[model samples]
Target: MKLGKEYQQLTPEDFTINPEQPEDFQQAIAQLVTQSTSWHGVVQCCGHDFTGEETSVSETGYGSTLLLVQALVKAELSPLPRLWLVTQGAQPLDSHPVMSGVVKSSLGMVKTISSEHPGLRCVAIDLDPQQTVEEQARMLMAEIWSESREDEVAFRQGIRYVAQLIDSHWTQSTLTVQQYQFLQQIKTASISERQNILRDYLQSEIVQVLGMNHEQVDLQKPLNDMGVDSLMALELRSRIKTHLEVELKISKFVEGVSISDLATEVNEQLEQIETNQENNLDNEEQINSAEGNNIDWLEGEL
Candidate 1:
């Protein structure tokens, strides 16, 4: 198969790969692993020849790449700062059965690895064959160095598409005028009423973040089990702190904690803070009243 102009343009420094012999392939990988030791971040481009049909050669190639990545991860003395997997397929990579199978399988593996090794900051990039090698290389390099937290990126027909998952929770410390008025109206409401309000707020936030409907979210189910990763958890925490002015530990948002439990905790903290504020204001007023009485008595004597 003829190499694409983009692939031809890539230099040895750009990427290192050897498919001729097992020892050479291992040696090239060792060099990469050694180079990665000093580098803060490493981006591995798993280039494959998509020309072949679904055959033993393609299967072995894909398996070899997977094992190499596993070896890199295992060889690292410390967790890698970031790991990016770049896979290229001809235009409509998903349409070709052989290429699609490999890409999909790779995607699943990367996603699982990302979940298991959160510190690796794993991401997958799918390159379009329609675009020039130059375009693909440029985009891939930018993504590797960019401080984007996006988990999935695709370059289709020279356009870049990024998909980021985040909670839609409002992160404003101060409520809007309308929200403030609504809260004021319900200040004298029962604890259950307040809890219900918070619960609804949290439910909406989770639904928006998870891209699901309110009915789909089980209040009692753990958020992690529902595919809420660390990034999502952090976003939720930020939203809660900003909206409710309640500081929650990161641990509270992890796997074992349910949304219902989180909402209840937030409500309790909000109530406690409000109660303390009210108590302080009452004490201040009492002190002022006492001082006024003393001043009035002194003035009469004078």
Candidate 2:
């Protein structure tokens, strides 16, 4: 029997949350942890004048894996800096003498970096060679300042809302029509549901729009590689709005580093957009009502 068919027979209870086997249900989570390391190397290399580094570590996915596991744990548990080395996967490593010393050394390194250094920040832009550093910085500042005080408050609230969504599995819960549409617009599937609506749209609409090939792209790659240049980033913004019929901020690119990360970021922005729109409508109605009341009072005085 095939592994796919056999794996389908497993139950959620078979993979309960525990310290012993954290990577049980969320393999994607583990994969993200690994990919984050590769992404870190790539980003670091691209940022500096270096050809990528070479190390004989079997765990090429170490950097991303460490960053994500730490982030998720911090987000879920303590907000402090710490690290964990998981010991279960398709290729398991025994807790033997050869690996034990290395694992301890790695943990020590994680603790040092997590405590001393601020985490890396990933950013995306839609600019060409024509834009100077000063020009780009000015543009970013203007965009940041465009948000009124009220919008800024709503934006922070939107981040909390997104944290909640991730806390809950991406289930189709109760949502407004627009919220539902936004979810549908960026929906992507794992290996199982690759042919489903969300994944299909991601491949054709998003992947094609960004000029990425199916073969060259894997689910784990950084989303920026999908021709996510400045123009394509704006194109993604426009397409998302057209498909979902909701406006979202471009700053979400700075927050989400990978394709999965981008999905989370977009969802958060969509929630913020919805909330802001609702608040604006309510304020407009209140203003109109107050104006009518003032006109009625003047008429009575006359």
Candidate 3:
């Protein structure tokens, strides 16, 4: 399967980056969305293993980042943020930055750490699955030019958008009812309450939705440390939306936050929801009891 074709078929927007110029690629991505200001940088991890003969890049255990960036350019997500990836022994660094403006993963690092001296095991990888390369660039321009608040919000939206995009490309599954309800709580809850609600529901839903043991998705730990990447976040976000029937911004509230915090937010919102429901039920019961004693219908018929 070609990454570009697959991405084009599965995704709603065009995301293409400069095959030759990483900087151009970043600028392109920022343009497609809103609320984004500037990109920190971009790094290509070791995922860019693509062959000219194939329609999409092969997921052949290495170098898929290039294909991903290519897709971004094609899709035209503007304000392309910077790119980052590990340095392959053969990578052309003079042309590409050690890390692009946006965050990135280093597959090379993963390979290196696998050896006896596994020191640099923990690293972050960011991918743009949404707008094209041009769009990403536009997003950057808008961000750089916009005010601070505007830039922050835009950046939040951009990452969230990218998370959703990646999720769409990677997974295809229907959501369960519980996932739906949990999503609703996440959307309306206040920041404090949302954290509580997320914690309560995430614990229950991780197994049901992600098919992992409770121990695997420990909410007490940080997401990056838990081995959760942008793609996983995207998958989680997608499932939550599918089940919850609402679109939650993965980047705005979910990104860079610890699983513990998320779980806490979820729990708080859930508690509030339960409280509200109970209050409504109590009011209904009181009204019913009062009406029962009145016997107005019987009196009128007689």
Candidate 4:
């Protein structure tokens, strides 16, 4: 361990998991967890996308990442490590609009994982791809060690920026009256209706962002194949989270997932949210009823 602090290196080989079963990934990481009784932090530098022959980013960024996160979740360590996922050009900065590769997808997974495992203190940092390796390394190392809680961060021209989804105001006065009414009723709409709305909203955003005509977007076609780069995918994911209250998976946006598939995923999230809400209400009612019975018993004793 460098700096005399307990740190652990989880290699690429250590990130292995069976697609059919998760036991190996779990056991491997559990052993790593035992190596440190309590860890100060853990850093994972997911490598950059291929430039030449293969020309694909999913295997490195998507599936393997899924495995690694699952392993960490399964390990069930007592004191979870503060995880920093470092990548080159993983996020979108205003100055640099070329959002490409699995790094961006990693950010999506980070958001989901952070919400599900708040103790992990997970964040994804995107380096300025144009900068020299030494410069990027210095900045990345500094940010990783710093006590910053910024979730998704990116560097542009030596400045750091964190991702935030500002409430969109541009939708006003742009759509027909019926569409406006639909927006007002979206939350109360049926599951199928909500899915349709999400699909329509995505289509509109894609058309506007990509400079494509209304007829050009194909819902069944993969966003990646339609030239949906990281910047576009990030924006789309942000808008979906802000408007529809669903964090669309990286696969839905990056790894050749189609618009129809995204809508279905959104619908499933909505259903899960509804189920959770009902369960909470039932629990509250039961608690209240028990409290009332206890009060009656105390009065009878008096």
Candidate 5:
């Protein structure tokens, strides 16, 4: 059935139950699915109630969401039964380790479900819990129906933030004028100099990604060990390819790859390009000289 007026005013208390045992909670979820014909959406809130023993909170929170998703998948008659996962308190980026881990894992689940089910709409909303439940519900409903193409939204201290995923890497065009000039200057530089420049650029990027200073990064260490997740890796690869004007595969950082090694590869590519340019110039000059000789012989015959 449609979650119309009754569901609009729903609160966290509606789903609260004193479970005699954990299995009882699962039974309750099963019953929820069995009774409901269809749902407009599902809203999950993680806030003060989610803060307890780390193990308990994490297990229960994640498990409950999992069950809800499973139930929704089975019962949702319409493709667009929106799922809104709400988190309270500090944003995930600035949260404590335990809280942050839980949020990240939850978001990961949302991403996976969204990827698998194109018709299903999943959004994660983070907001401060100091506001009234009505306010929170209003904001969530607005987000559920928002036409914005963002999957993540946050409301903090009277401010609203939306995350729109765009492919920054693939859209890059030719280098800027400054970049072209710099490339021209470096084209004739020694391989050692070229490698040093590339290495320094990579080191700077790694430090920024890790949210640290350059001195804190070890260029020789593997990037994965430094907490460079898949998303960060894509960003790093994008930055390098865009600025350095070199082609690089994302898998280069898959394993045993270091900044120094990447620098070496960039240096080799530069040298190859320079060599090809020189060969082309020499062939053009020779062709011009041959044409001139033929013209001189024709003049003498005339």
Candidate 6:
């Protein structure tokens, strides 16, 4: 509705291609583009259509999009119209890892195509699915009008972020004596004990973060489905780092992760930390190692 005024809105009947039928879908797309020899842009908004996890490229948008790319690239038009692939929460940014969606392939197609063909203008824009429709519309409009040469971009909270590749280094934080010992004990903990410990901690965090009763929280249900958005996710992640002394991506909460599932994930991270701490043990990294019994309450909680 935000773009209804400026752009000519096409109804579903006007241009909905069935990806299951490759040849027909390809033909439909080719004819659609041939409607005008020159154009401002042809935007393909994806991630709205539902496809199963087992769906192949021929049964998904990927195959249809491939055909479109071939047509656009081979067209004898003077100035190629910009091909815009707009998706929702399909990009993994530096901090907020967007929800991976089926549109990922289409985004990559346009980016690589733009590089191979200088005359073609390809813009891949990822919008935060958590944002309101009004905000997403504004982001799309801004990117459409801006003269940025960046082929790939993502918008979060009205801020535009472009992807870049640079030399990076792995920097580890100095763990305190208590944190190191806790990790070591956690690694030695039995599978059931580990689950009980971390699951209890995660339950407490969820109850506190969402202000829900402990009895009301279901360990098997996904946290995001219980209304943990990006902001709540940030708080939950911070709480984990503070108490557990482990850093986790914000995406961990939103990607259908239940308290039970996160407990297993936390246990795995603790194992990795146990190894790293042992290898990097130094004077500064080590303090008087606390006894494993210090976290005995962890097992007792269950």
**Candidate 6: stretches off by over 4 Å:** 1-13, 20-26, 29-35, 48-54, 58-60, 98-107, 167-302
Residue pairs with colliding backbones in model 2 are 33-64, 33-65, 34-65, 36-64, 37-63, 37-64, 126-230
Which digits, one per residue and each the tens of the lDDT, describe model 4 over residues 1-302?
A: 11112223457224444432445546656776676657666776665664524433433544545556677756766456677777776554544444444544676778877766666668887778889998787677666644444777777665566766674111122323233234445656777788788788888888888899979999999989999998888888877676555687555688988878887887788778767876864665466557656877999999
lDDT of 3: 0.42
Give the Cα lDDT of each candidate: 0.61, 0.37, 0.42, 0.65, 0.61, 0.64
TM-score to true structure, per model: 0.41, 0.28, 0.26, 0.44, 0.41, 0.44
TM-score of 2: 0.28
Ranking by lDDT: 4, 6, 1, 5, 3, 2
TM-score of 5: 0.41
lDDT for model 4, on a 0 to 1 scale? 0.65
Point out the worst 10-residue segment of candidate 5 by lDDT.
1-10
Best by lDDT: 4
lDDT by residue (45-159, candidate 1, tens digit) is 6655655555553243445445545655556534345667777762243343445556556567678766655556678777776668876776676566544456776665444
Candidate 2 lDDT over residue span 175-259, tens digit each: 3324433444333233234234433454456667756567765554565654466666677777766565545566554344555
lDDT of 3 by residue, 1-302 (tens): 22232212223234533343444444444443334434343434444333323332234323355444554445433333433333221221223323321212243433343231111112222223244657455444333332111101112223321112343222212432233234444555677776666566556655565567877877666665655566667777676556543354566233556667665544554466567766864665466446544665778878
Per-residue lDDT, model 4, residue 85, is 78
Q: Model 6, range 52-139, lDDT digits (tens) per residue? A: 4666664444555565666665554545567777877676553654334454575667767765654556777777777889768766
